[model samples]
Target: MSELFPDGDEARTLARLHERLARAADRDALLDVGYRLVDSPVGPLLLAATEAGLVRVAFDGEVREDEVLQELAEQVGARVLAAPRRLDRAAAELEEYFAGRRRRFDVALDLRLARGFRRAVVEHLADIGYGRTASYSEVASLAGSPRAVRAVGTACALNPLPVVLPCHRVVRADGSLGQYAGGPERKRALLDLEQH
Candidate 1:
Protein backbone atom coordinates (compact mmCIF):
# COMPACT_ATOMS: atom_id res chain seq x y z
CA MET A 1 0.00 0.00 0.00
CA SER A 2 2.86 2.36 0.82
CA GLU A 3 4.27 1.99 -2.63
CA LEU A 4 1.11 3.42 -4.23
CA PHE A 5 0.38 5.75 -1.35
CA PRO A 6 3.88 7.05 -0.84
CA ASP A 7 2.72 10.33 -2.31
CA GLY A 8 -1.01 10.25 -1.67
CA ASP A 9 -0.74 13.60 0.05
CA GLU A 10 1.05 15.03 -2.96
CA ALA A 11 -1.63 13.79 -5.38
CA ARG A 12 -4.42 15.26 -3.29
CA THR A 13 -2.56 18.55 -3.00
CA LEU A 14 -2.08 18.69 -6.73
CA ALA A 15 -5.79 18.07 -7.34
CA ARG A 16 -6.74 20.80 -4.95
CA LEU A 17 -4.30 23.17 -6.58
CA HIS A 18 -5.71 22.54 -10.02
CA GLU A 19 -9.27 23.08 -8.79
CA ARG A 20 -8.29 26.36 -7.21
CA LEU A 21 -6.49 27.50 -10.33
CA ALA A 22 -9.49 26.76 -12.51
CA ARG A 23 -11.82 28.62 -10.20
CA ALA A 24 -9.54 31.62 -9.97
CA ALA A 25 -9.13 31.74 -13.72
CA ASP A 26 -12.87 31.67 -14.17
CA ARG A 27 -13.45 34.32 -11.55
CA ASP A 28 -10.94 36.64 -13.14
CA ALA A 29 -12.16 35.97 -16.69
CA LEU A 30 -8.68 34.76 -17.60
CA LEU A 31 -9.97 31.71 -19.37
CA ASP A 32 -10.58 33.02 -22.86
CA VAL A 33 -11.32 29.51 -24.10
CA GLY A 34 -12.09 26.13 -22.57
CA TYR A 35 -11.66 22.86 -24.43
CA ARG A 36 -12.00 19.11 -24.11
CA LEU A 37 -11.65 15.92 -26.14
CA VAL A 38 -14.64 13.62 -26.50
CA ASP A 39 -15.05 10.23 -28.11
CA SER A 40 -17.65 9.63 -30.84
CA PRO A 41 -18.55 7.12 -33.49
CA VAL A 42 -16.42 8.96 -36.03
CA GLY A 43 -13.43 9.47 -33.71
CA PRO A 44 -12.13 11.64 -30.94
CA LEU A 45 -13.24 15.22 -31.33
CA LEU A 46 -11.52 18.22 -29.89
CA LEU A 47 -14.15 20.70 -28.72
CA ALA A 48 -13.26 24.30 -27.97
CA ALA A 49 -15.41 27.12 -26.71
CA THR A 50 -15.01 30.72 -25.81
CA GLU A 51 -17.05 32.80 -23.40
CA ALA A 52 -19.20 33.49 -26.40
CA GLY A 53 -19.90 29.89 -27.54
CA LEU A 54 -18.46 26.75 -29.11
CA VAL A 55 -15.69 27.95 -31.41
CA ARG A 56 -14.05 24.91 -32.98
CA VAL A 57 -14.42 21.14 -33.35
CA ALA A 58 -11.48 19.26 -34.83
CA PHE A 59 -11.22 15.57 -35.51
CA ASP A 60 -8.28 13.91 -33.82
CA GLY A 61 -7.02 12.23 -36.99
CA GLU A 62 -7.51 15.30 -39.16
CA VAL A 63 -5.63 17.78 -37.01
CA ARG A 64 -3.11 17.41 -34.22
CA GLU A 65 -4.14 18.65 -30.79
CA ASP A 66 -1.18 21.01 -30.57
CA GLU A 67 -2.03 22.56 -33.90
CA VAL A 68 -5.66 23.09 -32.88
CA LEU A 69 -4.60 24.70 -29.62
CA GLN A 70 -2.13 26.92 -31.43
CA GLU A 71 -4.75 28.02 -33.91
CA LEU A 72 -7.18 28.74 -31.09
CA ALA A 73 -4.58 30.74 -29.22
CA GLU A 74 -3.72 32.73 -32.29
CA GLN A 75 -7.13 33.31 -33.78
CA VAL A 76 -9.21 33.43 -30.59
CA GLY A 77 -7.17 34.30 -27.53
CA ALA A 78 -4.08 33.14 -25.73
CA ARG A 79 -5.58 32.25 -22.36
CA VAL A 80 -6.74 28.76 -23.22
CA LEU A 81 -7.19 25.99 -20.67
CA ALA A 82 -8.26 22.36 -20.47
CA ALA A 83 -11.52 23.15 -18.75
CA PRO A 84 -13.69 20.13 -19.30
CA ARG A 85 -16.63 21.53 -17.34
CA ARG A 86 -16.96 24.38 -19.76
CA LEU A 87 -17.57 21.89 -22.56
CA ASP A 88 -19.86 19.49 -20.68
CA ARG A 89 -22.91 20.59 -22.64
CA ALA A 90 -21.16 20.31 -25.99
CA ALA A 91 -19.87 16.84 -25.21
CA ALA A 92 -23.29 15.68 -24.06
CA GLU A 93 -24.92 17.05 -27.17
CA LEU A 94 -22.37 15.26 -29.36
CA GLU A 95 -22.93 12.03 -27.49
CA GLU A 96 -26.66 12.38 -27.96
CA TYR A 97 -26.21 13.07 -31.66
CA PHE A 98 -24.04 10.02 -32.18
CA ALA A 99 -26.52 7.87 -30.33
CA GLY A 100 -29.23 8.87 -32.82
CA ARG A 101 -31.20 10.50 -30.04
CA ARG A 102 -30.52 14.04 -31.17
CA ARG A 103 -31.26 15.48 -34.56
CA ARG A 104 -30.47 19.11 -33.88
CA PHE A 105 -27.73 20.62 -31.75
CA ASP A 106 -28.66 23.30 -29.26
CA VAL A 107 -25.14 24.49 -28.65
CA ALA A 108 -24.30 28.15 -29.14
CA LEU A 109 -21.58 28.78 -31.72
CA ASP A 110 -18.88 31.33 -32.22
CA LEU A 111 -18.29 31.68 -35.94
CA ARG A 112 -15.44 34.14 -35.78
CA LEU A 113 -13.08 31.71 -37.50
CA ALA A 114 -15.25 31.75 -40.61
CA ARG A 115 -15.74 34.99 -42.50
CA GLY A 116 -17.71 36.51 -45.34
CA PHE A 117 -18.80 33.97 -47.97
CA ARG A 118 -17.68 30.98 -45.98
CA ARG A 119 -19.72 32.08 -42.99
CA ALA A 120 -22.78 32.57 -45.15
CA VAL A 121 -22.45 29.09 -46.62
CA VAL A 122 -22.02 27.30 -43.27
CA GLU A 123 -24.75 29.35 -41.65
CA HIS A 124 -27.11 28.10 -44.33
CA LEU A 125 -26.15 24.50 -43.68
CA ALA A 126 -28.53 24.30 -40.73
CA ASP A 127 -31.37 24.47 -43.22
CA ILE A 128 -30.16 21.19 -44.73
CA GLY A 129 -32.09 19.26 -42.05
CA TYR A 130 -31.13 16.07 -40.27
CA GLY A 131 -30.33 12.83 -42.15
CA ARG A 132 -30.66 14.66 -45.46
CA THR A 133 -27.99 15.90 -47.83
CA ALA A 134 -27.84 18.74 -50.32
CA SER A 135 -25.55 19.12 -53.30
CA TYR A 136 -22.89 21.76 -53.45
CA SER A 137 -24.83 23.44 -56.24
CA GLU A 138 -28.01 23.39 -54.19
CA VAL A 139 -26.23 24.78 -51.15
CA ALA A 140 -24.63 27.47 -53.29
CA SER A 141 -28.01 28.45 -54.64
CA LEU A 142 -29.49 28.48 -51.18
CA ALA A 143 -26.65 30.68 -50.02
CA GLY A 144 -27.65 33.17 -52.71
CA SER A 145 -24.71 32.42 -55.02
CA PRO A 146 -26.24 30.05 -57.55
CA ARG A 147 -23.02 29.58 -59.51
CA ALA A 148 -20.57 29.25 -56.62
CA VAL A 149 -20.81 25.51 -56.25
CA ARG A 150 -17.08 25.13 -55.83
CA ALA A 151 -17.07 27.86 -53.24
CA VAL A 152 -19.75 25.97 -51.34
CA GLY A 153 -17.51 22.94 -51.19
CA THR A 154 -14.69 25.10 -49.92
CA ALA A 155 -16.91 26.54 -47.22
CA CYS A 156 -17.85 23.08 -45.97
CA ALA A 157 -14.22 22.08 -46.01
CA LEU A 158 -13.22 25.00 -43.83
CA ASN A 159 -16.24 25.05 -41.57
CA PRO A 160 -15.07 25.89 -38.04
CA LEU A 161 -17.67 23.80 -36.26
CA PRO A 162 -18.18 20.70 -38.36
CA VAL A 163 -20.67 18.33 -36.70
CA VAL A 164 -22.45 21.06 -34.80
CA LEU A 165 -22.98 23.05 -37.97
CA PRO A 166 -24.09 19.96 -39.95
CA CYS A 167 -21.52 20.38 -42.73
CA HIS A 168 -21.69 16.64 -43.31
CA ARG A 169 -25.11 17.20 -44.81
CA VAL A 170 -23.48 18.75 -47.86
CA VAL A 171 -22.57 16.46 -50.70
CA ARG A 172 -21.28 16.71 -54.23
CA ALA A 173 -23.75 17.22 -57.05
CA ASP A 174 -23.07 13.70 -58.34
CA GLY A 175 -24.57 12.17 -55.18
CA SER A 176 -21.13 11.42 -53.79
CA LEU A 177 -19.67 12.05 -50.40
CA GLY A 178 -17.21 14.84 -50.92
CA GLN A 179 -14.38 16.22 -48.82
CA TYR A 180 -14.69 16.72 -45.10
CA ALA A 181 -12.26 18.29 -42.69
CA GLY A 182 -12.66 15.19 -40.54
CA GLY A 183 -11.92 13.15 -43.71
CA PRO A 184 -14.27 11.32 -46.06
CA GLU A 185 -14.68 8.31 -43.80
CA ARG A 186 -15.85 10.49 -40.94
CA LYS A 187 -18.27 12.31 -43.21
CA ARG A 188 -19.64 8.98 -44.34
CA ALA A 189 -19.98 7.86 -40.74
CA LEU A 190 -21.82 10.99 -39.73
CA LEU A 191 -24.17 10.78 -42.67
CA ASP A 192 -24.74 7.12 -42.00
CA LEU A 193 -25.43 7.78 -38.34
CA GLU A 194 -28.08 10.31 -39.20
CA GLN A 195 -29.71 7.84 -41.58
CA HIS A 196 -30.29 5.31 -38.81
Candidate 2:
Protein backbone atom coordinates (compact mmCIF):
# COMPACT_ATOMS: atom_id res chain seq x y z
CA MET A 1 0.00 0.00 0.00
CA SER A 2 1.19 3.54 -0.90
CA GLU A 3 4.24 1.96 -2.56
CA LEU A 4 5.67 0.85 0.81
CA PHE A 5 8.41 3.47 1.07
CA PRO A 6 7.00 6.72 -0.19
CA ASP A 7 8.86 8.53 2.60
CA GLY A 8 11.57 7.25 5.00
CA ASP A 9 12.42 4.89 7.92
CA GLU A 10 9.23 5.63 9.88
CA ALA A 11 7.11 4.68 6.90
CA ARG A 12 9.15 1.50 6.50
CA THR A 13 8.51 0.36 10.09
CA LEU A 14 4.79 1.09 9.87
CA ALA A 15 4.49 -0.86 6.65
CA ARG A 16 6.35 -3.80 8.19
CA LEU A 17 3.98 -3.92 11.20
CA HIS A 18 0.99 -3.69 8.89
CA GLU A 19 2.30 -6.62 6.92
CA ARG A 20 2.84 -8.63 10.12
CA LEU A 21 -0.76 -7.96 11.09
CA ALA A 22 -1.96 -9.22 7.73
CA ARG A 23 0.03 -12.40 8.21
CA ALA A 24 -1.27 -12.81 11.78
CA ALA A 25 -4.97 -12.44 11.02
CA ASP A 26 -7.45 -15.29 11.61
CA ARG A 27 -5.18 -17.24 13.94
CA ASP A 28 -8.12 -19.00 15.63
CA ALA A 29 -10.97 -19.60 13.20
CA LEU A 30 -9.32 -21.15 10.25
CA LEU A 31 -12.85 -20.64 6.62
CA ASP A 32 -13.09 -22.78 3.57
CA VAL A 33 -10.07 -22.87 1.22
CA GLY A 34 -8.93 -23.99 -2.21
CA TYR A 35 -5.66 -25.19 -3.78
CA ARG A 36 -4.00 -25.94 -7.11
CA LEU A 37 -0.72 -27.51 -8.18
CA VAL A 38 0.77 -25.92 -11.27
CA ASP A 39 3.96 -26.64 -13.19
CA SER A 40 6.57 -23.96 -13.75
CA PRO A 41 10.00 -23.80 -15.35
CA VAL A 42 11.55 -24.25 -11.93
CA GLY A 43 9.30 -27.01 -10.65
CA PRO A 44 5.79 -27.60 -9.36
CA LEU A 45 4.13 -24.70 -7.53
CA LEU A 46 1.38 -25.10 -5.00
CA LEU A 47 -1.06 -22.19 -4.99
CA ALA A 48 -3.48 -22.03 -2.10
CA ALA A 49 -5.61 -19.50 -0.36
CA THR A 50 -8.96 -18.86 1.27
CA GLU A 51 -12.01 -17.24 -0.28
CA ALA A 52 -10.52 -14.15 1.31
CA GLY A 53 -7.38 -14.11 -0.89
CA LEU A 54 -4.37 -16.06 -2.16
CA VAL A 55 -2.33 -17.29 0.80
CA ARG A 56 0.47 -19.66 -0.07
CA VAL A 57 2.78 -20.24 -3.05
CA ALA A 58 5.30 -22.90 -2.22
CA PHE A 59 7.91 -24.55 -4.40
CA ASP A 60 9.47 -28.00 -4.22
CA GLY A 61 11.50 -29.30 -1.24
CA GLU A 62 8.73 -28.58 1.23
CA VAL A 63 7.23 -32.05 1.35
CA ARG A 64 4.86 -31.08 4.12
CA GLU A 65 2.39 -29.45 1.76
CA ASP A 66 -0.54 -30.38 3.94
CA GLU A 67 1.08 -28.73 6.90
CA VAL A 68 1.77 -25.64 4.83
CA LEU A 69 -1.84 -25.50 3.73
CA GLN A 70 -3.00 -25.97 7.29
CA GLU A 71 -0.74 -23.20 8.43
CA LEU A 72 -2.20 -20.99 5.71
CA ALA A 73 -5.73 -21.88 6.73
CA GLU A 74 -4.90 -21.03 10.30
CA GLN A 75 -3.38 -17.76 9.19
CA VAL A 76 -6.37 -16.88 7.05
CA GLY A 77 -9.04 -18.52 9.23
CA ALA A 78 -10.16 -20.74 6.34
CA ARG A 79 -10.56 -24.46 5.85
CA VAL A 80 -8.28 -25.87 3.16
CA LEU A 81 -9.69 -27.58 0.08
CA ALA A 82 -8.17 -28.42 -3.32
CA ALA A 83 -9.74 -26.37 -6.10
CA PRO A 84 -7.59 -26.33 -9.24
CA ARG A 85 -10.45 -24.76 -11.13
CA ARG A 86 -10.39 -21.73 -8.83
CA LEU A 87 -6.75 -21.31 -9.77
CA ASP A 88 -7.24 -22.06 -13.45
CA ARG A 89 -6.41 -18.55 -14.57
CA ALA A 90 -3.23 -18.40 -12.49
CA ALA A 91 -2.17 -21.84 -13.62
CA ALA A 92 -2.81 -21.12 -17.27
CA GLU A 93 -1.11 -17.75 -17.14
CA LEU A 94 1.90 -19.26 -15.43
CA GLU A 95 2.06 -22.01 -18.01
CA GLU A 96 1.96 -19.49 -20.78
CA TYR A 97 4.60 -17.40 -19.10
CA PHE A 98 7.00 -20.28 -18.60
CA ALA A 99 6.39 -21.43 -22.15
CA GLY A 100 7.36 -17.98 -23.43
CA ARG A 101 3.88 -17.29 -24.72
CA ARG A 102 3.19 -14.59 -22.16
CA ARG A 103 5.37 -11.81 -20.83
CA ARG A 104 3.33 -10.26 -18.05
CA PHE A 105 1.36 -11.72 -15.18
CA ASP A 106 -2.42 -11.31 -15.24
CA VAL A 107 -3.21 -12.81 -11.86
CA ALA A 108 -4.36 -10.98 -8.75
CA LEU A 109 -1.82 -11.41 -5.93
CA ASP A 110 -1.90 -10.85 -2.20
CA LEU A 111 1.51 -9.32 -1.46
CA ARG A 112 0.81 -7.97 2.02
CA LEU A 113 3.97 -9.64 3.34
CA ALA A 114 6.00 -7.29 1.18
CA ARG A 115 6.54 -3.80 2.55
CA GLY A 116 9.00 -0.90 3.01
CA PHE A 117 12.26 -1.12 1.05
CA ARG A 118 11.35 -4.64 -0.03
CA ARG A 119 8.05 -3.43 -1.39
CA ALA A 120 9.66 -0.55 -3.25
CA VAL A 121 12.31 -2.82 -4.74
CA VAL A 122 9.65 -5.32 -5.82
CA GLU A 123 7.62 -2.59 -7.47
CA HIS A 124 10.70 -1.51 -9.41
CA LEU A 125 11.43 -5.12 -10.33
CA ALA A 126 7.93 -5.43 -11.79
CA ASP A 127 8.83 -2.71 -14.24
CA ILE A 128 11.97 -4.56 -15.39
CA GLY A 129 9.99 -6.40 -18.10
CA TYR A 130 10.66 -9.73 -19.79
CA GLY A 131 14.06 -10.28 -21.45
CA ARG A 132 15.48 -7.37 -19.48
CA THR A 133 17.62 -7.30 -16.36
CA ALA A 134 18.95 -4.84 -13.79
CA SER A 135 21.75 -4.79 -11.26
CA TYR A 136 21.01 -4.78 -7.55
CA SER A 137 22.51 -1.32 -7.37
CA GLU A 138 20.12 -0.12 -10.05
CA VAL A 139 17.19 -1.39 -8.06
CA ALA A 140 18.51 0.29 -4.92
CA SER A 141 18.88 3.58 -6.74
CA LEU A 142 15.35 3.22 -7.99
CA ALA A 143 14.27 2.60 -4.40
CA GLY A 144 15.74 6.02 -3.45
CA SER A 145 18.80 4.57 -1.78
CA PRO A 146 21.54 4.59 -4.37
CA ARG A 147 24.04 3.16 -1.91
CA ALA A 148 21.86 0.29 -0.70
CA VAL A 149 22.95 -2.39 -3.11
CA ARG A 150 23.10 -5.02 -0.38
CA ALA A 151 19.75 -3.90 0.95
CA VAL A 152 18.31 -4.31 -2.52
CA GLY A 153 19.60 -7.87 -2.58
CA THR A 154 17.85 -8.49 0.74
CA ALA A 155 14.63 -7.16 -0.69
CA CYS A 156 14.93 -9.44 -3.68
CA ALA A 157 15.42 -12.44 -1.41
CA LEU A 158 12.33 -11.47 0.62
CA ASN A 159 10.13 -11.08 -2.45
CA PRO A 160 6.95 -13.12 -2.13
CA LEU A 161 5.64 -12.59 -5.64
CA PRO A 162 8.73 -13.92 -7.49
CA VAL A 163 7.99 -14.18 -11.20
CA VAL A 164 5.00 -11.88 -10.95
CA LEU A 165 7.23 -9.30 -9.25
CA PRO A 166 10.12 -10.18 -11.62
CA CYS A 167 12.84 -10.54 -8.99
CA HIS A 168 14.74 -12.86 -11.33
CA ARG A 169 15.38 -9.93 -13.59
CA VAL A 170 17.61 -8.31 -11.03
CA VAL A 171 21.15 -9.59 -11.25
CA ARG A 172 24.62 -8.77 -9.97
CA ALA A 173 26.36 -5.75 -11.39
CA ASP A 174 29.03 -8.00 -12.86
CA GLY A 175 26.37 -9.70 -15.02
CA SER A 176 26.18 -12.65 -12.68
CA LEU A 177 22.96 -14.40 -11.74
CA GLY A 178 22.40 -13.73 -8.07
CA GLN A 179 20.43 -15.50 -5.37
CA TYR A 180 16.71 -16.16 -5.69
CA ALA A 181 14.26 -17.57 -3.18
CA GLY A 182 13.68 -20.40 -5.64
CA GLY A 183 17.46 -20.87 -5.98
CA PRO A 184 19.96 -19.48 -8.46
CA GLU A 185 19.59 -22.31 -10.95
CA ARG A 186 15.89 -21.68 -11.09
CA LYS A 187 16.65 -18.01 -11.50
CA ARG A 188 18.89 -18.80 -14.45
CA ALA A 189 16.20 -20.99 -15.98
CA LEU A 190 13.63 -18.24 -15.59
CA LEU A 191 15.88 -15.73 -17.26
CA ASP A 192 16.73 -18.20 -20.01
CA LEU A 193 13.05 -19.00 -20.56
CA GLU A 194 12.17 -15.35 -20.88
CA GLN A 195 15.11 -14.66 -23.16
CA HIS A 196 13.71 -16.82 -25.89
Candidate 1 overall Cα lDDT vs. reference? 0.90
Q: Relative to the unseen true structure, what is the Cα RMSD of model 2?
A: 15.5
TM-score of each: 0.91, 0.73
Model 1: per-residue Cα lDDT over 1-196, one tens digit each: 6676675489889888887887788778789888989988887899999988899999997889999999999998899888888888999999998889999989889999999999999899999999999999999988999999999988999999999999999988789888888888889988988889
Residues 63-103, candidate 2, lDDT per residue (tens digit)?
A: 46777676666655455656555567777878888778999
After superposing candidate 2, which stretches have Cα over 4 Å from the reference? 1-33, 50-56, 62-67, 70-75
Cα shift from native, residue 137, model 1 (Å):
0.9
Query: Using TM-score as the measure, which candidate wins?
Result: 1
TM-score of 1: 0.91
Global lDDT scores for all candidate models: 0.90, 0.74
